[model samples]
Target: MRIAFVSFETVYHRDTETSQRFRTVCELFAARGHDVNCYCAGFWAGEESAFERNGVTYHAVSSGTEARSSFLLRLPFVLATASPDVIHASAQPSSQVLAASWGSTLARAPLVLEWYGDDGVSDTRWSRLATGRPGRIVTPSELVGTWVREIGADGDIVDTVPNPIDCERIHRVEPGEAVDVIYARRLDEGANLESLLLGLAELRGRDWSAKVVGDGPERETYERLARDLRIEDRVTFVGDLDLEERIAAYRGAHVFAQTADHCVFPTEMLWALAAGCVGIVEYHANSSAHELVEGWDRGFRTTSEDELAEAILAAGDLEHREYDEAFAEYDRSAVADRYLELYRTLQEAQGLL
Candidate 1:
C-alpha cells in the first residue's frame, strides 16, 4: 500500500518522542515492503526542497522565520507529488491534519489522524472543528480516546493504538550496571520533578541513587532544590542526553519513576514498559498511568507525595514484577503487524484489497 505520513513539525523536532513514534511506524511499514513517504515541515540544514531518507521519501514544506504561513500554497505541491492510499496524520488540527484532509479529498486516500499529546484537546476550542473532518482518529490510550468520544466523533471511526516503540533499541542488557532509580522527562516545574527531589530528600537515609536525565526551563531550579534538600550529591542531573543514552539509562537503572503531570502523557508510560523497568507511575485524573499498571502486576502507581516516597523506597525490587514475556507479543513487530492488518482492512473495505 502507498502511505503518506504527514507532520507539520520540522524534522529538527523529529528527535522527540512523538516524531520518533511516527518514524518507528513508518519503518515498520517499510520493513514489511509497503511504500511509505514522510512529509515534514523543513527547517533542517541543506535538506533540499524534499528528499528520501532510507527507503522512505520526505517532502519538505517551507516556512518563514516563524510559523508556516505558506502551508496553503505548499499543500498543492505535496498532495500532487505523493498520491497515496492513506494519509496518517500526527497531532491535532495543525497544518498536518489539515493537509491530510485536503490530500484525502484530492488524492482519494483514507485519513488516519493520530493524537499524541493532550494539549490541543484539553486547552483549545478550535481543536474541535478541524479534528472533526478526518476519516478516522487514532489515540494512544483510553484517556485520549474518552476525550475524543466526548467530542462526539463517530464511535467506530476512532480507535486506540498504543504508541510504538523501537523495542530493539531498548532491548535489555546484563543484570544491571547501577542500583539507581531513573526519572527521565523534560524536567519542567509543572512536571513536578521538584516534588520528586523533596521525596528523595525525605528518604536520604535509604542510600539510593537517583539518575535524573533531561533539561528544561526548570533545570536550574531543580538543581538548586536538590542542593537545598541536601540530596544533591546523590542526585545526578546528567544534563540532557540523546535517545540512546536515555534508553541505556533506563536499562542500566533498576527502576522507572515518572511523576508526570498527573500521568496524562502516555509516552513515559509506554517507554517505562518498553525499557523493561518495573515502573512506578503517577496517578491523577485524566491519567492512563493506572491503566498501564493494571493487572500486569509488573508495575506500581502512586499519586500522593507519601505514596511516591514509599514507591521510591521500594524501587529496589525492580525484578519482582515477573517480567511479562507474554506482553512482549505486543512489542513493535506485533504492533506493526496490527497496523498492516488495519491498512489491509481499509483496502478491503474499499474493495481495493
Candidate 2:
C-alpha cells in the first residue's frame, strides 16, 4: 500500500513526541514492505523539496521563511501529487488535518486521522473532521477514545491503539550502590515537579539519589525547589538525553517516578517499566498514567504525598521482576501490526482490499 503520512513538522526534527511516534510508525510501515511518504513543513535546511531518510520518502511542503502553518496551503498539492492509497495524518496543527481533508477529497483517498490524545480536538477543524467528511479516527488509548467521541467524532470510525515502544531497545542494567530514582519530563508548566521533589526529600533518611532528566523553561525553578528542599546534594539535574541515554537511565534506576496531573499515554513510564525500573505514579484526578500503573503489581498509585513517600521507601526492598512479558502488549511490532490491520480495514471499507 502506498501510504502518505502527514505532519506539521518534519519527523527529522524529532522535537515532539508526535514526531518520534510518527517516525516509528513510518519506519515500521516501511519495514513491513509498504511504500511510505511523509508530508511535512520545511522548517530546516532552507529550500530543500524532497528527500528520503530511514527508508521513507519525506516531502517538504514549504521552502521560504513562511511560517510552518503555510504548509496547510501547500498540503493539498502535495497530497494530490503523491496520490497515495491512504492519507494518514495526525490531528495536530489542526490546519494540517483541514488541508489533508481537502487534499484527500481531491485525491480521492481515504483519510486516516491518527489522534494522539486530545491535543487540539476542540479546534473547529478537528470538530469538522470528526463530524463531517467521514474518515477513520485512530486514538491511542480508551481515555483518548472517549475524549474524541465526546467531541463529536464518529463513534463507528474511532479506533483505539496503544502507543508503541521499541522493546528491543530497552533492557535492564545494573545500577550503582545508591538507590537511583529517575524522573524525566519536559520541565514546563503543569509538570508538577515539586511533588516529586518533596516526596524525594521525605526519603532523605533512605539511601537514595535521583537524576532529573529533560530540559524546559521551568528547569531553573525545579533546580531552585530541589535546593529549597535541601535534597539538591542528592539530586542531579541531567537535562535532556538522547534516546539511548534515556533508556540507559531508566534501566540504571532503581525506581522511576512521575507526579503529573494528567497524561494521554505515559510513554516514559511505560519505557521505564519495560526497562526493569519499578514504577510509581502519584494518583491525580483524571491522570491517564494512573490507569496504566494502578493494577500492575510491580507498580503503585499513591494518592497523597505521604503515600508517594512511603511507596518510594518500600521500593528499595521490592524484588525486581522481568517486565518484558507484562509489556508485550505495547511492543512496537504489536502496535505496527494493529496499525496495518486498521489500514487494511480502511482499505476494505473502501473496496480496495
Candidate 3:
C-alpha cells in the first residue's frame, strides 16, 4: 500500500515523542514493502523541497515562515504528486488536516484521522472533521477511542491502537551497584520536575542518587530548583542522552520516576519498565500516568510529592521482577502490524482491495 503521512512537524523539526512515533510508523510500513511519503514543513535548516530517507519520501512545503498558509497552499500539489492509497493525518485542526481532507477527496484515497487525546483541541472541531469525506479515526488508547465517540465520531470508524515501544531494543540488563533513580522528560514547566527534585532532596541523606535526562526551556530553572533544594550535588542533570546512553541509563537505574501531568503511558516510562526498572508515577488531576501502573505490582502510583519521595526512598527494597509481558504488545513491530490491519480494513471498505 502507498501511504502518505500529513503532519505540520517532522521528526527533524522537533524530535518529540509524537513525531518520533510517526517516523517509526512510516519506517515500519516502508520496511514491509509499502511506499510511504511524509508531507510536512521543512527542517530547522530551512530546506524547502522533497527528500527521501530509507524507503519513505519527505515533501517539505514550507521553509520556516508562515507555516499554516504555506502548507495549505502547497498541500494539494504535493498530494497530487504523491497520490497515495491512504492519507493519514491528525484530527487536530491544522493546515495538514484541512489539506489532507481536500487531497483525500481529490485523490479519492481514504482518510484516517488520528486522535491522540489532545485536550487543547475542542470536541466541536473533531466533530466537524468526522462529518467530512467518509473516513476512519485511529486512537492510541481506549481512552481516546471513547473520546472520539463522545465528540460525535462514529464508534464503527474508531480503531484503538496503543503507542508502540521498541521492546527488543529496551530489554533489561543487570543494574549497576549504586541504586540510581532516573527521570526522563522535556524538563519544561508542565513536566513537574520540581516534584521529583523535591522528592530527591528529601532523600539527600539516603544512599541513592538520581540522573535527570532531557533538556528544554526550563532546564536552568530546574537546575536552580535542585540547587535551592540543596540536592544539586546528588542529582546530576544529564541533559538528553543519545539512544545508547538512554537505554544504558534505564537499564542501570533501580527506579524510574515520572512526574509529568499530562502524559498517557509515556513511551520512555514503558521503556524503563521493559528494561526491568521499577516504576513510580505521580498522580496529577489531568495526568494519565497512574493508569499505566494500575493493577501492576512492579509499578507504583503516588498522589503527592511526599508519596513520590517515599516511593523513591523505598526503591532499594523493591525486588526486581520482570514485567516484560505487560509491555510486549507495545513493541514497534506489533504496533506496525496493527496499523497495517487498519489500513487494509480501510482499503477493503473503499473497494480498493
Candidate 4:
C-alpha cells in the first residue's frame, strides 16, 4: 500500500505526543513493507525538499514550522503529487484536514484522520468543516471519538483504535524487586497523584511500599504532599524510568493506580495491565482510563480516595502474575494490523483494492 501521511509540523518541528504518534505510525507502516511518505515542514538541516529515513520518505511542504499558512497553501499540491493509495493525517490545526481533503480528492485517495485529542481543538468554522471532511476518523479511545462526533463528524466514520504497546518487551523484561503499588505518569497538575497518595496514607498501618515512576513540574508538589501525609518514606519518587525500567516496576508491583485528571488514552495503565499488575483506575470525567478495565476481572474502578484504598486492598487477594495475555490485542503488531485493516477497508470502498 502507498500511504501518504499529512502533517504540517512533524515531530522534528515540535516533539509532542501527537507528532510522535504520527511518526510512529508512518514508521510502522513502512516497516511492514508499505510505501509510506510523510508531508510536513522540513526538519532536516538542508534545503532538501525530501529526506529518507527508516524506509519512509518525508517531503517538505515548507521550509520550517513557522509558516502555517504557507504549509496549508502548498500541502494539497504536494500530497496530490504523491498519488498515494490512502492519506492519513493528524487532526490538529484542523484546517490541515481541509487541505488534505482537497489533496485526497485530487489524488483520488481516501483520507483517514488521526485525532489523539491530546492537543486542544479550536472550535472554529475551519475545524468544524475539517471534522466532516475525512472519510474515516481514528481516535485513541471512544472518549475522544465522542468528542469528534459532537464536533460535527459522523459517528459512523469515527473509530476507536487504541495506542499501541510493545507487549513482547513487557513479557521479556524481568520483574524488579516487588513493591506493593505503583503510579506512573508525568507529575503535572493533571497527574492527580494526590488521590493516590491520600489513598495510600489511609493504609499507613499496612506494611506496603509504592513507587512513583515519573517526574514533571508537579514533582515537588507531589513529593511535599507525600511528606505531609507522612508516607514519604513508604512512597519512593523514582522519577521517569525508560521503557524497560518502567515495565519492570509494573511487573514488580501488585497494583497500578491511574489518577490523571485528563487522558485521551491511559497508555501507562495499559502497559501495567500487560505487565500483570492489577489495574486500578480512578474515575475522572475527562479520562478514558476506565474503558480498559470496564469488564476485566483483574481491574478495579474507583471514584474516591476511600474506594481507591479499598481497591488496593482487594487487589492483594489476586495471585501475583508476571504477564497477562488479554492485552495482546493492544500489541504494536496487533494495533498496526487494525490500521492496515482500516486502510484496506477504505481502499476497498473506494474501488482501489
Candidate 5:
C-alpha cells in the first residue's frame, strides 16, 4: 500500500499529542512494509527537499515551518505527484485538510482525516467547509467522532480507532514496588488532580499511598495542593517518567485514577489498564476517559469525588495483576491493522484496490 500523510507541522515541528499520534501511525504503517511518504515543512537540518528516516520518506512542501499560505498552495501539487493509494492527514489548521482534499482528488486517492480534537481548533469558514471534504474521518474516541459529526462531517464516515499501546513492553517490564493508587498525565491546567487529591484526602485514615507520574506547568500547583491537603506524605510527585518507568509504576499500582477535565483519549489510563491496574475514571463532559472503563469488570466510572473515593476503595477487593490480556486489541499492531482495514475498504470503494 502506498500511503501519503499531509501535515504541515509534524512531531519534529511541534511535539503535541496529535502530532505524536500521527507520526506513530505513519511509522507503524511503514514498518508493515507500506510505502509511506509524509508531506510536511521540512524539519531536518541542511538543504534537503526530502529526508528518509525509520522506514518512511518525508518530503518538504516548504523548506522551513513558516508561511502557512505557501505550504497550503504547494501541498496539493506535491501530493498529486506522490500519487499514493490513500491520503491520511491531520485535522488541525483545517485549511490543510481542504488542500489535501484538492490533492486527493487530483491524485485519485481517498482522503482520511485524523482528528484528535485536543488542540482547541477553532471553527473557521474554511474549517467548516473542510469538515465535509474528507472521504473518511478517524478519531481516537467516540466522543471525538461525535464532535466531528456536529461540526459538519458526515457521521457515517467517522470511525473510532483508539491510540495504540505497546503490549509486549507491558508484559516484559517487571512491576515496581507496590502502591495503593496511581495517577498519570501531564499536570496541565486540565489535569484536574484536585479530584483525586480530594478523594484521597477523604481516605486519609486508610493505609494508601499514591504516585503521580507526570510533569507539566501545573506540577507545582498540584504539589502544593497535595501539601495543603496534608496527603503530601502519602503521595509522591515523581515528575514525568519514561515509558518503562511508567509501565513499572502502573504494574505495581493496584488502582489507577484518571481525573483529567479534558481528554480526547485516555492514553495513560489505557496503559495502566494494560499493566493490570483496576481502573477508576472520573467522568467529565469534555473527556473520553470514562469511555475506557464503562463496562469492564475491573473498571469503575465515577461522577463525583465521593464516588471516586468509593471506587478507589472498591478496587481494593479486586485481585492484583501484573498484566491484563483484555487490552491486547489496543496493541500497536492491532491498531495499525484497523487503519489498514479502513484504508483497504476506502480504496476498494474507489476502485483503487
Candidate 6:
C-alpha cells in the first residue's frame, strides 16, 4: 500500500513522544514492505523539503512561520505529489487532519486519523469538525473507541489500535538485580517531577534510589527539593539515558511511577513495562489511562503522596512477573500486526468506494 503520512511541525521541530510514536509506526509500515512517505515542515532530517527515512520518503513543506507551523497552504502540493492509497496522521483535529481530508478528497484515498491521546478532556475543536466529516477514526484504546462512537463517528469506521512497543529491543537487556523504584520523564514542562522527588524523599533509605532520568526546565528546582527533603545523597539523578540504556533501566527497575494527571496515553509507562517495570501511575484515574489499565495486571493507581510511596514499595517488594503473567499482547510485533489489519481494512474500504 502507498501511504502518505501527514506530519505536523513535530516531524522536524522536536523529538517528542508523539512525534517519535508517529515515526515508529510509519517506519514499521515502511519496513514491512509498504510504500510510505512522510510530509513535514521546515528542515526534516537534512532533506530539502523532501527526504527518505529508512526507505520511507519524508517531505517538509514550508509552513511560512516557525512558530505555529500550520501547513494549510501546502496541502494541495503534498497531495499532488504522493497520491497515496491512505493518509494516516497522528493527533486530533489539526492542520494535518484538514490536509488529510483535502488530500484524500483530491486523490480519492482514505484518510485515517490515528487519535492516541485526548486533546484536553474531550476532542479538540478541530476534532469535532474532522469527525463531522468523513474519515476513518483510529484509537489506541477501547476507551477512546467508545468516545469516538459517542461523538457519532461511524461505529464501523472506528478501530482500536494500541501503541506498538519495541519489545525485542527493550527486552534484550537481560533482567538482573531489580532496583527499588524509577520515575522517568522530563523534569520540567509540568511533568510533575517535583512531586516525585518529594515522594522519594519521604521514603529515603528504605533501600531504594529514584532513577531521575530526563533533563528539563525543573532540574534545578527538583535537585534543590531533593536536598531539602534530605534525600539528596540517596537519590541518583542519572539524567537521560539513550534508548538502549533506557531499556536496560526498565529491565533492572522494579517500579515505574509518574504523575501524568489524567492524560489519555502515557508513552513512558508503556516503555517502562516493555523494560519490565511494574507500573504505578497517578492519573486522575477517571480517564482513558484508567480505562486502558482496567483488568490489566502489573498496573495500579496512586492518587496521593502516601499512596504513591506505598505503591512504590509494594511494587518493589513484589516478585518479578513469571513469563506467562508478564507478557501482554501490547508488544511491538503484536501491535504492528494489529495496525496492519487496520490498514488493510481501510485500504479495501477505500478501494470499494
Top-scoring candidate (lDDT): 5
**Please, what are the lDDT tens digits per residue for candidate 6 over residues 263-305?**
5566667777756677777766434555444565777776778
lDDT of 3 at 280: 95
lDDT of 2 by residue, 58-114 (tens): 877766325665787888887998888989987776667778988988888888887
The CA lDDT of each predicted structure is 0.69, 0.78, 0.75, 0.90, 0.91, 0.68
Give the lDDT ranking, best first.
5, 4, 2, 3, 1, 6
Task: Summing lDDT over every window of 10 consecutive residues in candidate 2, give the lowest-scoring window.
Answer: 170-179
Please give the TM-score that candidate 6 achieves against the real structure. Answer: 0.82
Q: In terms of TM-score, which candidate is stronger, 1 or 3?
A: 1
**What root-mean-square deviation over C-alphas does model 4 reach?**
1.1
In candidate 2 the C-alpha lDDT for residue 15 amounts to: 61
Q: What is the lDDT of residue 161 in candidate 1?
A: 75
The clash tally of candidate 4 reads: 0
TM-score of 4: 0.98
By summed lDDT, the worst window of 10 consecutive residues in model 3 runs over 170-179
lDDT of 5 by residue, 83-157 (tens): 899999999888899999999999999999999888744567876787888888999999888877776878889
Per-residue lDDT tens digits for candidate 3, residues 9-52, read 76777665566667777788888888888887776344447788
Question: Looking at candidate 5, what is the lDDT of residue 245?
Answer: 93
**Candidate 3: which stretches are off by over 4 Å?**
13-17, 41-49, 60-83, 92-95, 117-119, 123-127, 130-134, 142-150, 171-177, 201-206, 227-230, 313-315, 321-325
Q: Residue 73 in candidate 1 has what lDDT?
A: 58
Query: For model 6, where is the 10-residue window of minimal lDDT?
Result: 319-328
